[model samples]
Target: MRFAISIPQFYADGEFDPAAFRAYFARAEALGCYESAWAQEMTLSASPQLSPLEAMTYAAACTSTLRLGCVVFVTTLHSPVHLAKSLATLDQLSGGRLEVGVGTGGPQRPFAAFGVDRSRYLARFTEGLALTKALWTRDSVTFDGEFWQLKDARMEPKPAQKPYPRLWFGASGDGALRRAVRLGDGFFGAGSSSTAAFAAQVSVVREALAAAGRPAAEFPIAKRIYIGIDSDAARARQRVNAALAGIYGRRVPAIEEAAVAGTVADCVAAARAVAAAGAELILFTPLYEVPEHAGQIAAEIIPQLG
Candidate 1:
């Protein structure tokens, strides 16, 4: 399975330091240990954070080889036409190394703050995805949808990649899984999901692929996992839990339940389980306090998988 790292845009102190984050990505690429680097999107959070798009743009500029991705952009917050254009621009600028992942906006505050009708988020997400795809592949597009209307409008300087950059969906429910199979190139399982829960969602996605007459191999699967590795398993777990409490203002149940933390052997075992469950890519989000722990994972745990 491919391995990637996620950089938190906000720190425990509720401040963001873009330059420091960019330096981390540079170091990750230099280590020759990551396949991609992704950013998270949290629209109306209680913390200070850099926007996902801005973070991605910065990472794209700093790294030449590591694929740049958005873990998932909230689709219901912006016009698809505008978002498509912005993403296409990034794709062009990044030399075709952009992977776009999107989800229906969550957290009522963001939707309410942005003046988006929360009731129609799902419909808007579907319509926006359809429009974005058309804009990328077709020379021109005209569509009349419930939320948007376009008249022979065309987006230029199409993404460097053919059709468009790879599109992934971050989904949590059965309906979202079905929609992802129908519309996306891949699905990103929720970060907090259990192994059993991930297995169920993967089954749903595969079934949708089958019903659509699409080969399962054509669609990749990705999962975000919190990982902490140290010589002492108990210490590792404590560190991860501490980080979670700092970031989320609550305690994570345990490494076994909410994260992958332990000695190197234990972490490898956890990753192996996820791979066995059919996850093609595993994106690691190191606990907040131990962001640098990712480098240790790159050096110690990832090599064992091969």
Candidate 2:
């Protein structure tokens, strides 16, 4: 199984430690278990978190071989032109080591705050995705889109990766999973989904690919799993719950239940279930005590997986 780790984002005001952050990547690279490092996006949140692109750029500078990306940018809330330009620039800056993940950000998001029409966000998402890809690959683009339009537009300095970077979709429902198969290079299961639910989603993705006459082997599948490791299982559970609550702004029982926490053996068993559920790439995201969890997971859990 391919293993990846979440790049550290949790920070307090005036508490950003450059040395520690750089050290985290350095250590992960030295361990030789991680193929990539990922960041998550939350444009408007109660938590103080760095922007995914900025964090990813910093990570790219710190580590040479580790691929960097964001799990899902709320595409509906963004200006496609600006977002596309930024991602293309990031891909170039990272020397083509970029994977783009996007989603509609759900109906619950504060759409009005971002000037998004809640009812028509999905259309905006799909159109925006098309526009972004066009900007990346097209030399001069002329397009008429409902949300955006361009006439003979030229985007210089194309991405380092040919045909642009890989696009991964963060989706849950059957319809969205099918769209992932239709439009994205991969499907990324959310951290909030239970193992059974994730497995079901994977089934839908595979079926969609089959119906589309696309080979499943060409489209990768990945999942972000909230995880923690501690000998005292109860403590691990408590820590993960508290962390999720802080991130989500409330207590979500489903999210708490979905997290993997406890001893090394317990985590191994849970990760095995994820692999069995069809997650070729498992992104281990520790919400609290990140460095310690990263170290232990790389040293203990990854070896056990192999």
Which candidate tops lDDT? 2
TM-score of each: 0.91, 0.99
Model 1 error, position 223 (Å): 0.8
Displacement of residue 155 (Cα, Å) in model 2 is 0.6
Residue-pair clashes per candidate? 0, 0
lDDT of 2: 0.91
lDDT of 2 by residue, 13-32 (tens): 99899999999999989988
lDDT, model 2, position 262:
90
Q: Tell me the TM-score of model 2.
A: 0.99
> In model 1, what lDDT does residue 41 have?
82
The global C-alpha lDDT for each of the candidates, from Candidate 1 onward, is: 0.82, 0.91
Off by over 4 Å in 2: none
**Residue pairs with clashing backbones, model 1:** none
